[model samples]
Target: MYRLKPGIKQNPQRRWELPDRIFFGHGACHILAGTYLEIAPLKGFHAERIIPGDGFAGNHIFVTDGEIAFDFHGYSLRNKLLLHHTSGWARVSDPGWYCRIEDVDFNLLDTRALNARKMLGPDQYFGDPRIRARSFLERIDHIDSVKKLARNVD
Candidate 1:
């Protein structure tokens, strides 16, 4: 079964909804296929990052934003994602062929965020570490969400 992965579709009608102020945080989960669920920087998505042997748990994604006050690579991130949108760490079920935001407990997009530049930024394979360490981890940086998110991956 081929489910649609979220991205900026050429057709506006096809755009997925996202909650307001959702910084994809960092990192992405890889599904059975070669595709990945990385932060849609909107520009720097590299196929090279998602390797067959690479697990989504430890892979680092360069996330940047001024408001994020949590760990960029751990449990804190999962909370933030759940609290804001795409609840329960999205993943594919019912055969587990791909990862998708299924039966979300919360709404996915802010009315404004979907149409704004928020999702149009460039996706980086690796961003500035100094900024990432400081910016992505302001409030809850110690907790790791890899395990929390892994459960969702079937």
Candidate 2:
């Protein structure tokens, strides 16, 4: 059976207030999504990198499998995830949301996600966002099939 995990707690009241690590919702979507793209496959899950589709401008990125999306806020339905975007930046349903990154295309998205690592500046407690993501996964009870991924990864 597939298990759904509650979304990761985001700093909704105070952005960037979490001093110990780069807060996932605070311009760190790329980092979180990029981490999943790299790690999920190794654990036998398929993850696709995505960005907002045409006519919408967004600074966020996430991973999905055409149904659930994994981002700084953990796993959630793709549309449900967008509803939580109350920051008044992007309108809901604008540009029809999510566009997939083709495998053949030059991935400026991944490059940006990778480049985001250096921009954390003083918030980089764990040295890298991917490391922080792993730490987050280890402590949380996410999907059922991959519950052991963190402990099992070498």
Q: Write the per-residue lDDT of candidate 2 for residues 88-152, one digit (tens) a residue.
A: 33444454455434322223225444455233332343345566666765655566533443344
TM-score of candidate 1 to 2 decimals: 0.19
TM-scores for all candidates: the values are: 0.19, 0.50
Q: Would you list the clashing residue pairs of candidate 2? A: none
Clashing pairs counted in every model: 17, 0
Q: After superposition, how far is residue 139 of candidate 1 from its true place, in Å?
A: 10
Supply candidate 2's per-residue lDDT for 6.
32
lDDT of 2 at 24: 62
Model 1 score (lDDT): 0.27
